[model samples]
Target chain A: METDKIHRWHDMGGQPAGEIKREEHDFALWEKRVDALQVLTSGKGYFTVDGLRRVLEDMGEEAFETMSYYERWVQSVNQNLLEAGVYTIAELAERMEQVQARGETYGECAGSGE
Target chain B: MPHDHHDHSHDTDGLSPSGHPYRPDQDHKLTRWQAMEIAMRELLVEKGIVTAAEITETVEQMDRRSPADGAKVVARAWVDPSFKARLLENGTEAIRELGIEPGVLKLIAVENTARTHNVVVCTLCSCYPRNLLGLPPDWYKQRAYRSRVVKTPRKVLAEFGLELPESTQVRVHDSTADMRYLVVPARPEGTEGLDEAALAELVSRDAMIGVATARHP
Candidate 1:
């Protein structure tokens, strides 16, 4: 039994458009920023729109099906940054740890002008 | 494009421990990618590729866009026959006449008729006409919507409180590329005297998405 038969993204092909529950929610502050971040970076020529789309399309099945739309975009932007050698993996990990250790949310830390 | 090598073995589907989806127990917080996005923005600014002010300006730019813009376009199409002809022919060019930049995306305005209804979806990665319409609704980007909207549009339209007559043919436009779509909803009955602004008020984002018709005034 081949358990993982088809990729979730590929499986979306030709599926009937059906009655999906319409549940709209306000976007989180960070979510809104992520949208802008993608646009800003792309606007600066760090990556093309098609390149960003390709990055999104190439996301793994598990992540694709599970992560929220903007989450995927954030990840895509990160991947693009790393690929462009903006910073090394070690630096990214170190910064992430520093951000986590602040004991306050991103909003708080950024609000304090840190 | 370099692939994301980051591991995501702990990604949850916003499910509760009891197995219900969209549980409210999950408080509003930044997901890992969101945190990373903030970090990336800082890094990009540090690299001199883009400035914080630029990012702020871009955020403001995106914030300024809303469905109200699309409603105005649809409303004008409903009242002005010449505008409607132009919108149906070249959506990108037509929208520019109203000071709206169609941008890089190829926008195609599909008309809804007594016999035909149109809905737009991008099965691949939530490709939407963000220039014409602001950021898509949350539901539009979900896997359930991206997957189902193409195959069972009639059922989906009904879910949006829009049940078309059996004689009305539903057409689902799969936006597979740079070409984005906007469904010009049919002008509702009994509003022949409404001004463009009043008519625009009747058109909702759902109507322009072809999920529902304009509300009767």
Candidate 2:
């Protein structure tokens, strides 16, 4: 009877999986920036860590398999920020367009243009 | 463009300034998510919610926290019985004695003895004590580690080269919610004369995660 309960994709305890890949990589600048943004925004009471996790879980299993760690985090953080009314979706879309128009590379787009 | 005037001749064979191999981010084409990150950060700063300096400071603070902090606590517990007792009783408060702020994390320090071994995993997501022991490792966030660690801890531990005896019990702690786990692995033998600082050297990140025992020095 306990097995009949509907299990969510995010609740992945005791699931069958492959061998653990023992590789490790250093955090990229963009990844670290995403992490920093989450910490700063959460600390300022915009959203809790649980709020972020909720959005991440709602993203579905396809996202988990396709997107990288920070990619999902950026999406979750953006969703939480939008839900909190930190900024409008239109404003975010405009900003993202401006960022993409800056250059083809991350270093070119991420600068403050000082 | 801001980068137009900068010199591009300082080559380090694709390594970043921190000596790690550069992730394909800066030189590679901008991704949708990277654009989103830059956009969101800029928007937040423009709206006066968080300053650029504060974001930088937060990243620096997180970077400063490492397994070394957890190692110090384990080392102290190895040397002081009262501290060990206090740590097992109340991990959050006991860690504060060493000046480590766990923030709102409800830490539960699990001890490994001759009869029992403890391991930790976050089945839902990667909920680690980043305040005390830095970010969770790459494997820790992977599906294999999260899914199988709870179901077959012995097989998982064996994958990490830790072969426990049949008599010893393996207790897997699932960090499904707020409470985080820190495994205080049994100290290695023949190190009774070592001081706390020296003892700290033997405690690696894997040991504290319960995937492997503390390194023998």
Candidate 3:
């Protein structure tokens, strides 16, 4: 069908790959928070699901290989928010720094915000 | 502090009730992505962009959506010819009639027959009908399944332990954009005596995904 020339990295249909891994895990609390952020922000019109998909695709195959599903999603959500001007890089960087200093564990870090 | 009261120490050394290894608890060391999530969420709240209550509500709503919802739809279609017609004609509206919201995406219900089988994949990305079926399984979002399902559906289905006869034609639906698919597996033999609820019990998540058939119970 001559589709090879046009296929992007994320457009993986028909590409040869390894066997499917059947193992599954329940989501972590933080992962659920990431999912919630994606839904809530997009629901509030900060970005569309298309915008989220665009960033995830643009992240390239390396990210697909390395990041867990919600990890990549959180990154994409953050990027979309940046593009939407919900917050600036400076604010994010400073907030991240502050978040890092609060605690070494997610429960500790996430608790201080509320 | 909110999560401090729960005790996860009991499951730390063993598989969870679901028989899968426990995912690391929140007490585990935070990663960079975790930090990013916390920062992003707090920032949005600080700016009054979205309230904390809204995020919690949204997550709860998503948690409420599971394969059982899709199973109910499939079972209803199996028992009622008219509902089956409505579901095949307009999946979103038909599901809505059962009080299940499909969000903004178009839903397409593909019926499996003696000669035709249907399976779905998202070759572009993991575009699942999460509003109807909860989150997709991890395998569905993997590169292998996404890449191979469209090209070699029979082989993929075989991996899922479903072997269709050589005469059966496999139709693969790629969720490339706005549409999502649900496969209504044909009723298993001897299920004629079962009511809707009992039939629903036979519909597993993979069955609706077309990786497997409704189990013979």
Cα displacement (angstroms), candidate 2, residue A28, comes to: 0.8
> Which residue pairs collide in model 3, if any?
none
TM-score of each: 0.85, 0.92, 0.93
The candidate maximizing DockQ is 3
Kindly list the per-residue Cα lDDT of model 1 for residues B1-217, writing each as its tens digit. 3755355424345544433344231244434664576667666677787788877777777878888899889998987899999999999999998989988778899999999999988777677877767878778877677787777778777778888899999999888657899999889999999999999899888888888888999
Model 2 residue B161 CA deviation in Å: 0.5
Give one digit per residue, the lDDT tens place, for model 2 in A1-114: 354237798888887789999876678878989999998999899999889999999999899999889999999999999999999999999999999999899989998722
Flag regions of model 1 displaced more than 4 Å: A1-11, A16-19, A111-114, B1-31
Q: By DockQ, is 1 or 2 better?
A: 2
Q: For model 2, how does the per-residue alpha-carbon lDDT over B42-131 read when each residue is reduced to its tens digit?
A: 999999999999988888888899899999999999999999999999999999999998787799999999999999999999988787
- The number of clashing residue pairs in model 1 is 8
Docking class of 3: medium
DockQ-based ranking? 3, 2, 1
Worst 10 residues of 3 chain B by lDDT: B18-27
What ranges in model 3 sit over 4 Å off?
A1-5, A112-114, B1-14, B24-27
Error of 3 at B59 (Å): 1.1
Instruction: For model 3 chain A, give the 10-residue run with minimal summed lDDT.
Output: A1-10
Question: Worst 10-residue stretch by lDDT in candidate 1 chain B?
Answer: B17-26
lDDT of 3 at B79: 93
lDDT of 3 by residue, A1-114 (tens): 455767889989998789999987777778888999988888889899889989998998899998898989998999999999999999999999998899888888887554
